[model samples]
Target: MPAGTFTMGDSSGDKNRADGETPRHEVAISAFEIDATTVTNDAFARFVEETGYVTEAESFGFSAVFHLALAAPEADVMGPASGTPWWAGVKGADWRHPGGRDSDLDGRGDHPVVHVSWNDAVAYCEWAGRRLPTEAEWEYAARGGIDGAKYPWGDQEVDEGGWRANIFQGEFPRHNTCEDGFLTTAPVRSFAPNGYGLWQMVGNVWEWCEDWFHPSTYRRGTTAEKRTLVTDPAGPESGQSRVMRGGSYLCHLSYCNRYRNSARSQNTPDSSMGNGGFRTVALRVESQA
Candidate 1:
């Protein structure tokens, strides 16, 4: 059980971060139980086998594949790339086939599963008797026990003695030596948990939130419009993309540097691509007899 009050977001989190994380604000939340790490492949597989569940990607016949994931010879090809020409649609890019056709969970049973859509996550949560965290709840948990200091651990960047979350350890896009001992999503518990006992709050793969992304909904976060400020934002009433938090392994300091605890982004809940994934949160209820 992790319970604490934390400063939601602040400009001090990342000194050179995008405007989306600005105007750090104070947010308080009640204590709750959160999975220490993102749901794992094996865990998800069990859920499917038990309930005969099939994910959206599986039903749709394909999911989006990262450019680099297709570098292997045996890797299935993705084509008709649009927004990010590099992103290709792979027929087998579901949780079971993380890297499209060729790649497998392998020894990565503990690594957080990726390529999940919001609906998929919701289904899994329902099956587990859990639910997706509200946007406010997620922000509070990500901050861990830290209050408004910036970042899960504080304003400081990865220091010499301390290691941060599992984001891009090397240069962006090309040339990853896996300095963090992982080229992709590390084991769910690979790194230390934040003060709130939540893993991958700052990095790993982005987790889907129940909220739909609306620039007017969030007071902070990068947006050119004043209408973007949203309170207790549950995302847009109707929109193509839902909100996503906790940057992915694809995030890099040089390019998509939004791995910060408070930084937020979105994707079409119906669109299954990229390394988007999710985690489950629990609600504690007292029963009256």
Candidate 2:
């Protein structure tokens, strides 16, 4: 991991930019090692098998799954999330079985693990002796060394030539063209890595970060008199939800454009969904001078 300063929020007054993304500010981050790819099914399965740990979804008896991915009983019983009916709360939708009781990892060993909550991510990080990247660290890493770029690879064309990260192509929620060759989560490293050799940083799944969500966290830094150089911001002291970055396969211009490097979203720490997953980071130990 390389430590440096970078602009941290949306500088473009893009109409697609969300309100929480405004007041673009500068952030300096210390060196830290982060996983090149989001946690995969095989890695997560190993953690589960070794620790015999049960994810919150398993204990809660249900979790959010994409409505299109579920059918029959699972879909029938668990109503969709308010407004965003694309997300259905399905019984037995744990990290191991993303769709429901009937679903399994199958051949998706390399795919980024889904149906994981912030708490679940923290647990995995703890077991692995790592920690979730802070919201600032996440955005910096996602930028992949290119400052103020719209996307990780520095192109907003999205599906220009059927390349780039995995995201909704056709019509979001209603349809997915799968132009990127994936309707849902793609295998880790399925696409090109960024400038920092980080894979799937902008899409595929929303990675959990170590920060509480607040809409105006960057507003103060934007003041003309205040020093805009913030170092390792940890977000708000308290919030209803934890921060999530990188967007997901469900992202589309029709409804959501959060796949941008600066875009952010959040969910309850206990809420696990098919579009959510995470990677871990480790503090770089410095030798005494």
Candidate 3:
């Protein structure tokens, strides 16, 4: 665990930033240990094997899989998500079958497990004696040692010399250049680690956090008179969706520019998708005392 203070949101001049990321503010984080990488298929498999736990996708009998991964026939039969047409609700698309019943982990044991929900992540964290990082903690950690940088690495171009993260390349939803040498989920350690030695903190998968989704969360925390210095803010008390940080491989600058450290998104607790996964964080026992 490493404790520190950091700026918590995007600046007004930051391009492609969403309204939710407004009112840039500073946050003080307490000491905590976050995973260097997301939980892999092997790790999640062990959890399921030992406890016989079933993922929400499995229980619901379907999940949102990327359209690019679906076969032409499957894609035709299963239309894309209403809001984001790039994703398709694939039947039997559980964690085991990432693209439906035909898909399997195969040689991707080291890849981050997908089609996981916030509830499933919570169960894994509980079983592992850890918890999800709050959105503030997640941002603080993802920023590494740098302040207000666009990525875990400095604000260099994504493919400066070569691919840094596993984000989408070329045209989105239609064609992928695969310049990063990946079409779907890359291995958990496919890229270099951030300053904190955290792998894939900004891409490959969208990590679930412990905060509730509220567009004006930061705005609500401030008054017209003055700004409040919120230490270790835990986000809203209640909401319909949970916070999801670190955009996935489906992310592209052409559309979703949420692969940045401070960028955020959300999903229902039970909504599982192929790009949704999570990492765990352990609070310092001494701090808890």
Candidate 4:
């Protein structure tokens, strides 16, 4: 995106206020190069093959998997996560075995690799000579230059003119109608690209951002006289959880209606789940010669 200023945060007026998407503010973003799609299993596989690196999930011998998508047998299943019964901690669940030990990336190499933690994504970035986009940059790119638009395509609903994203169509965590031709994750390029030519920016998987999450990050440093134009806001200086943007396939209107441009979520740097993944942004290296 070229250097430009745009209003950031919930313009819809219907977002979950607790998610820190409030206090709508203007932000000026610098031009940066971002990947058109989330990193695929194939891409990650190359990173692993070359570096011989093991992901956090692989090290832990388990990762969170949606109950409906669990392919592990009763022996490999470790029960549901606390509070979110829809997710089960399955042993042997990693990026390679997304569902479980029984699952493989046979024909799904092009799909976004899940069960990747923020630390894992940063490891991949280090190997790939790239970095995760900041929360501000991610939102700016997802907005596609459309100031304060709800969805990436515009303010139109996901199911309005057709399936604009790969989110739950039926009752979430129970039955997915697959109205969008996807029960789990669709290909990275399943939906139409946003105006910035970025694909699946708001669905398929939650992309990690390089920012510590805080509920009141937007409300800081504001006065009656002047509205600060936060240029390239990098989020809080310290927090336990990093920001995650672009809701995943598990997102539904009834529950996680966070598949919009301004929606936000967070998780610990080491947390990994079936619905989590990330894309990288190229680092601008200044010429030394």
Off by over 4 Å in 2: 15-19, 71-76, 221-225, 287-289
lDDT of 1 by residue, 96-127 (tens): 88777677878978877777788989989999
132-246 in candidate 4: lDDT tens per residue?
9999999999999889789889989898888899998887779999999998999998879999999999989999999999988888875113687778888889999999999
Candidate 3 local distance difference test against the native: 0.86
Task: Give the candidates in order of lDDT, highest first.
Answer: 4, 3, 2, 1
Number of clashing residue pairs, candidate 2: 0
State which candidate has the highest lDDT.
4
lDDT of 3 by residue, 1-289 (tens): 4778888888325544453887778778888899999999999999999999988888987888887786333543367778889888887788998877888899999999999999999999999999999999999999998988888898886799778999999888799989999898999998799999999998899999999988888878452126766788998999999999989899898888888887879999999998989999884546553
Local lDDT at 227 for model 3: 71
- List candidate 3 stretches off by more than 4 Å: 15-19, 71-77, 222-225, 287-289
Q: Evaluate model 2: give its lDDT.
A: 0.84
Candidate 2, which ten residues in sequence have the lowest lDDT sum?
10-19
Write the candidate numbers in order of decreasing TM-score: 4, 3, 2, 1
Q: Mind giving the per-residue lDDT tens digits that candidate 2 earns over 54-132? A: 9998899988888777733634347878988888788877887887888788889999999888999999999998999
